[model samples]
Target: MDRLIVMKTFVTVAKSSSFSAAARELAISGSLVSRHVADLERQVGVRLVNRTARSVSLTDAGTRYADFARRILSEIDEEDTALSESRDRPEGTLSVICPKWIGTLDLGDAIAAFVKAHPLITMRFELGGMSDRNYDFLERGYDVAFHTRDLRDSNVLVRRVSELPFVLVAAADYVRRHGAPTTTAELAEHQCILHPNDPVWRLGAGAETSHHKVQHPSVVANSYLVIEKLVEQGAGIALIPRRPAVERLASGDLVEVLPQHQPPARALYAVHGPGGHTPERVRIFLDFMTVWFRSRPAAHAA
Candidate 1:
């Protein structure tokens, strides 16, 4: 089998996690798919797939190789598209991945505008969990990712889109019942809703920084939306991004606590995989999003 065909087969099988499914998608026989994968594994001198009667899973090495294979295939597609399309018109699928809460709010509007402007280009938007790492985007064929955390990956291009302000807030009822904290020390007395990753809240005022480990949380969750909902229902206090909590805060459903001390703002980044050539469509979309975010009231305030 050709190396390219073998690579494609391996990638398909890895993605679908079943040789039969890959074969069906590729219009090839299951045995042929298996043989191609086996040949590729033998040539590479590594076991790519762990096969069982019930299911199949990729080995650690297989997962890494799959990432490489997908990139290679994407590059090939880009090259073919560039050679075929006119320079004036940019067209192709632009897949993006972003945290659920952010995507559900303003990011969705950004994408909608991009699509409206460039009807020739298609898009795939994935709403992922908060803790999802950058590599997961590359592995899943995402051309771009909207991430709030600082990333250390040199393989991707990271561009700052905007700074997001995080504020500690609670339901007005909860604040009235439990009494709003006037100082950092008072935070310990409140039934805080904790972000699992940020167990120790970092409260900042001017040049001063204070870290407090929340002793007891009425609710702890990985999702910002969940935390906001809990806080809105007066279940507990939570730290949330300004955009998601804005409506609640305005409606008095949630009130800012210790307004003088806020959590350090996090920068939102637009990240792309390493390919010497980034698509013109991808570039345009990213640029538009950056400008759109900057013009937004929430980002401007931050």
Candidate 2:
């Protein structure tokens, strides 16, 4: 007996709960389905199912065996499909995860374009709750992830895809009401709008980098989108990524403060699992991202 066929028969029987129904689905006679189940039970040395005059139900042991069988069958199917995909064409689900701030601000257009270009690839781009732990994506079953922070892990492959320049900005009203700071130290004296991840703002460039704690933040949130809104509403001053705020900055709704003391550009990296036979989907996406970002103006991002 082919073990895989037997397992599939057993799984079908377990799902349908009746041999006749299983046989109908598998395009076989009910007796064959029964024989398959009996063979599986005999091989396992356990009574796999309990039968009544009118109905059939799985026993305790049968329930466990059915679950195991389903998992084995699923894994086999996936492996077979993956092998086929490698020989044929790029077609599979590509799961991605990214920080919500980046997703909303800068990554949206690229995602749209990737999806549009690759009709064979189904994308599941989940935003928010990305882990700080290295290779957490492997555990979470993600194909790729976008990260901005400096990673210490050498185990995961990272490609620097883009750089985002951050600007210190506040509404004209906020600046008028609260006055602008000439130095980083004065930010402590003013109410700041801060993201929880980088609440301690690192101001200035290179050796001039000075950390200013959000001593008295009028608004505190984990999202840059929200923090930027608060700043635009004249709630407080904030260091926000400039791309999203460009229109407001031009309209004079927001103004760049401390222009000489700009923060370091945030590095956006495309992260994936360590060396292996990289999947065609992953390979294609990385290439697409590299091209997409390379075409983007660095001065605008910087």
Best by lDDT: 2
Tens digit of per-residue lDDT, candidate 2, span 95-161: 9999898898768888899999999999999998788786998789998889898776887888888
Clashes of each: 0, 0
In lDDT terms, how accurate is model 1?
A: 0.84
- CA lDDT scores, all candidates in order: 0.84, 0.86
User: Candidate 2: deviation at residue 47, Å?
Assistant: 33
Candidate 1 per-residue C-alpha lDDT over 1-302 given as tens digits, one digit per residue, 9 for 90 to 100: 68889999999999999989999999999999999999999888999999999778999999999999999999999998877564335677889888776786667888899899889889988887433566777877888988888888887889898877888989999988988989999888888898787799888856878888988887889888788888888887788887867777778888888787878887889998877777787888888889888788564443
Query: Can you give the TM-score per candidate against the true fold?
Result: 0.67, 0.70
Candidate 1 off by > 4 Å: 1-88, 129-136, 297-302
User: For candidate 2, what's the RMSD?
Assistant: 11.6
Candidate 1 global TM-score: 0.67
